[model samples]
Target: MYASYKNLKIEVKFQGQHVAKSPYILKGPVYHENCDCPLEDSAAWLREMNCPETITQIQRDLAHFPTVDPEKIAAEIPKRFGQRQSLCHYTLKDNKVYIKTHGEHVGFRIFMDAILLSLTRKVKMPDVEFFVNLGDWPLEKKKSSSHIHPIFSWCGSTDSKDIVMPTYDLTDSVLETMGRVSLDMMSVQANTGPPWESKNSTAVWRGRDSRKERLELVKLSRKHPELIDAAFTNFFFFKHDESLYGPLVKHISFFDFFKHKYQINVDGTVAAYRLPYLLVGDSVVLKQDSIYYEHFYNELQPWKHYIPVKSNLSDLLEKLQWAKDHDEEAKKIAKTGQEFARNNLMGDDIFCYYFKLFQEYASLQVSEPQIREGMKRVEPQTEDDLFPCTCHRKKVTRADLLTHVRTKDEL
Candidate 1:
C-alpha cells in the first residue's frame, strides 16, 4: 500500500519536556521564489557590456586613451549612493567575529566544518575568542567560557558589553549545511532503534516567548520578503505534522532533542518520516518524495532512488560540455562563489565586519605599541585578514596605515 500523509510523524522534546503534538502531512504544491533569475540577468548584462572581442580591442587601444587622476575619480564617487548607506562599518579597534555557513538544507554541517577548518588553519586573534551558537554545539559537552565563547540562543538577548561586535546573521551556506547535517544525523537515528524510530519523529516551535514576538516576525517579513517565504515554510511544516509532537515547551538543541525523543534499534536501522508542507507552492512538491523517504533512509540504495534519474551518462556529459562552452560565464560564477566565501568566511572579513561596533567598547585610547604587540601576537596574513578591520590593541584605519607606510617609503 502506498503511504499516506497520515503515516508520517514527528515528536518534539525541549529541555526534556514535551509540550504539544501534531500530524505530519505532505501538502501538495511547493513553490520557490526565483531568487537567481535577477542574478542571471545581471550576468547577461555584464557579458553584453564587456564582450570578449570588445575587451580585446579596448586593451589594444589602451595606449591611446587619455590619462586621468585616479584620486579625482575616487573623490567623485559618492560615499553613500542614493539612500543606501553602507551596511558595514570599519574602525581600528573594533573586534568582531562574523560567522557564515553554506548549503540550503543540509549545508550547515559543511559550513560548520569549513569554519572549524578555517579556524584551525587560519591565524588566531590574540585577545579574541571564537564562538558558535549554544544550540548548535554538541549537547553532551558542557560549554567552557574560559576555553571558547558561546552565543546565546536567537530568542535570547545577550549583553552588549560582553560582545565587542554585533553578530552578523548566518549565511545561506551555513543554513544549508545545517539542514544536511540535521538530515544525516536524523537518518542515523532512524535506522538504529526505538528512539531513532521514524514513528517518534516530530517538529516543534520553541523560539519566541509570545504571540507579540511572532507577530513582530510577520512585520519584519513585510520589509524583507525573503523572510516571508522562509519563515512561513518553517512554521507551516511544524504545524502540519500530526505524528510529530511539540512546538516543544522551551527551546532545545537539535542534537539533544533528536537523542531523547527517539530510540536507536540494535540492528542499526532508523525510523524515518516526512515533515509537513510549510510553503504554499509547488517547490515543496518537487522535494516531497525525498524529504521524507530518501532523506531518512539509512541505506545508500534507497537514497539513490530519491535522486532524479539521469537517462544516460552521455546526456549528462552533454550538459557538462554545454557548461564548458560557456567558459567565461562559468568562470564568473565560480569567481562569485569564491568571492562570497572570501568576503563572508575569511578571517579578516569576520574581524572588520564586527570591529566597527566593537570599537565603541574602548574607553582608553589605543597606542602604537599596543597595536604592534597585538599584530605580533596574531600575525594575520592575507587569508586571515579577510575581515574589514584589523585587530591591534587600538584599531587603526586601513587608509591611515597605508598612508603611514607610503610616507615611510618616501622618507
Candidate 2:
C-alpha cells in the first residue's frame, strides 16, 4: 500500500490548535447548478482549463507545474479552503475562534496555511479554546463582508470564517493553484516595460462565472466591444448551461495577462483571486468596488495603483475612456500598482502580514470559553473515507522553498 505513495501527510498546526492536517477530501470545481457528475468526470473537465506546463524555466526543468495526482495532493489541504462557513461580525462578546468549513470546498489549503503560518510567529498567543457549532449554523454570511473589513480582520470573508489572511492572491485566493505562481517560483511575470508598449488598448478579463458581476461584465463587453475584451472560462459547465454566459468561453494562457494595456479585475465568489498578479503586470487594473476584501486591500489606493469602478460597474466605460485619453496617467497608475505589488505583496511580505494580523487578533480575545448556545463540534474526514478532489501551492513564508525535501512533510 505504501509502495506508490510519495508525500504522505500535511498536518497544519497554529498556536497548539489543529488548524487542519491532510488526508482530507475536496469537492473539486464542478458546480453545474443542476448536474451531479462523478469525481473523475468533474476532475477531467477541470483539467482542460489547467495550466499543464510551468511558465518559469526552473519549473519546466524540474517538471513541477501540474501535481503527480490532484486528489492525492488535495487530501493534505486543510479544511478552511473551499467550503461555505458561518460568517460573522466578530463582536467582543464572542469568546471562541470558530472555523466551520469543508475541506473539499476550493482553495482550502492556502486558506488554512495563511492562518496557521501567522500563529507560528509567537507562542504567548492564545489558541482556539473551544469549537463552537451552535445547534444551527449562524455564521454563514455577514451583512458587511467587504474586502479586508475592520471586524474580524484575520478571517477570510465575513461570509465565511475562512482565513482572510495575507495571501499574494487574496483576491489572488482562488485559482487552479496546483501549478501556478507560488512563492517558490520567484520570477513573476511582472510588467517590465511600460504600459505604452502593450499591444491591446482595450481592457480584458477571462475567467468563469463564479459571481453575477462576471456575467454582467460579459454583457457589458458584448455591448462595448471596442473598450472591453471579457470572456467566460468554463468549457464543460457552460456547454451544458450557456444561458447566463456570452458566446465566448475561451482558454487564456498565463502570458495572455500581459497582452493588453488595460486589465479588468472583477470579483468572483468573493474578491478576485487574480488581482495581485494583474496589479503586478504592465497593464492598468480596472477594479470594481466589492464588499469582498483581502488582507492588503486597505493599503491599496484608488487612482494610485488602480482605477476604481462602481461595484455595479456602471462607470467602466467612462473609466476606460478617461484612461484612453489620459494615456500618461494610465501608464503611471499601472506602474505604481506594479511597484506596490512587487514591494509589498511579495511572499515574505504576505507571511509577515499574516503573522502581525494573527498576533493582533489573538490579543483581542481575553476571557473564559463562551461557547455558542447551539454550536456542536464536527470532525473532519479524508479522501479515503470520502472521495477527494483538487490541489496545492508553495508556501511563501519559507526561505528555502526551491529545495524539495520530498517527504511526507508540508508541500
Candidate 3:
C-alpha cells in the first residue's frame, strides 16, 4: 500500500522543546548532523546536549513530534551538494545536520535535512515545500510508482524523458536558506583558519623534493656548469664561458661536429656521456639525479627546453616504457608525490569546497516560530557552562591569571 500523504511535515524538536513549527509533518523526533567529531563524541553530544532533558520531555508530550536517532539520522544525509547548494543548519547543539531522501536516490537527503533544520531554527513558519526532479530512470519510475511523491512545485513537463529535470538546480530561495544556516554553523565551528594558513611559503616547501633538491640542482647548474660536470664525471676540464657548445652539446649527435672539433671527450667516453649536463645560461652544466621533470627542464633555456638531450634519452625511454607497463602504479606514485606540499596536498580542493558549502548553508533563514516553539516547549536547565574546562579554556586567559596571581601574591 502507498504511504498516506498526511502532508508529511517533519518537526525537529530538541530535548522536550518544540524547536521548529511548520504545517508540514515531520517523521520522527530525532535529527542528524554531519560533524568533525568522532562517532563517540557525535553520539554523546547529541544525546546530552542536542536532546537535553527538557527537550526530551517535550518530545514525549507531542503526538506528532519528530525524533532524532543519531544512527538513523546520519544515514539520511547526502554526500555531496550541487555547486549552488550549501550544507548548513541551525541544530540545537554544535553539531552538523544532514538530511537525504529515503528508499530512492538519497543524494540530496543530507541537504534536505539541513534545509529542514534551518527552516525550523531560522525561518518563522516558512511555507516551504520539498521537491525532487524526476529526470532519471530510477527517480522517474519511483515518482511514477508513488514511492517518492512531489511535495512542492507540482508543475512539470510530462513529455520530457529525462529522469531528472533541469529545474533540479537549486533555487534562489533554497540558496538563501542555506546561506543563513551556514553562518550559524560557522559561528559554532569558529574560525581557526586553514591548516596551512599560518605557514610561510618557504616553510610550506621545506620538505618538498621538488623545492629542495630539484630547484637546488637547477640553480647549481646555472651557476657553475663545468664544476658540476667535473664532479659528475670525476674529471676536470678547462671551464669555458661560451653559450654555443654547452656541456650537454658534446653528447648530442647534432653537436658531434663541435665535440670532435674540440676533442671534448674524457678518456674514451664523450664529455656529455661521461657527465650528464643540462644547459644553463650560455653553457651546459652537470645534471642531478632528481625525479621531477619540470626542474630538469627549467635549467635549460626556454627555446631549447623541449629539445631532447643525449644524456636524458636513456632515462626518458626507461620512464616511458615503465609508464606504459605500469600506468596505475605511475599514477599512484604521482598522487603520493603531490602530498608533500600544501598547494598540492590531497583533498585540499574538496575540503575547501565542503567548507564553502558549510558557510553558505549556515546563513539560511530558519523559521523563528519553529525555534521559538522549540524553546517554549523545552524548559531551561542550569547546566555547567564550564568556562574553566581544560578543553574549552584559552591559553591567553590563563596567562592573564598568572600575571594577576604573581603580582597579587608578591604584594
- TM-score top scorer: 2
Q: Count steric clashes of candidate 1.
A: 75
Candidate 2 lDDT for residue 43? 30
Cα lDDT of model 2 by residue, 77-195, tens digit: 22332244322211112212333333233243344433342222111223332121211211324344332112132324434433345443441332212234341213345333334
Clashes (backbone N, CA, C under 3 Å), per candidate, total 75, 26, 71
TM-score of each: 0.19, 0.54, 0.18
lDDT of predicted model 1: 0.25
Question: Which ten-residue region of model 3 has the weakest summed lDDT?
Answer: 199-208
Tens-digit lDDT string for candidate 3 (194-249): 22222111100011121223234323435544322211211123234122223332
Cand. 2 Cα-lDDT = 0.51
**Residue 340, candidate 1: how far off, in angstroms?**
19
Off by over 4 Å in 2: 1-163, 167-185, 190-195, 235-244, 367-411
Residue 213, candidate 1: Cα error in Å is 13
The stretch of ten residues in a row with the least summed lDDT in candidate 2 is 129-138
Which is superior by TM-score, 2 or 3? 2
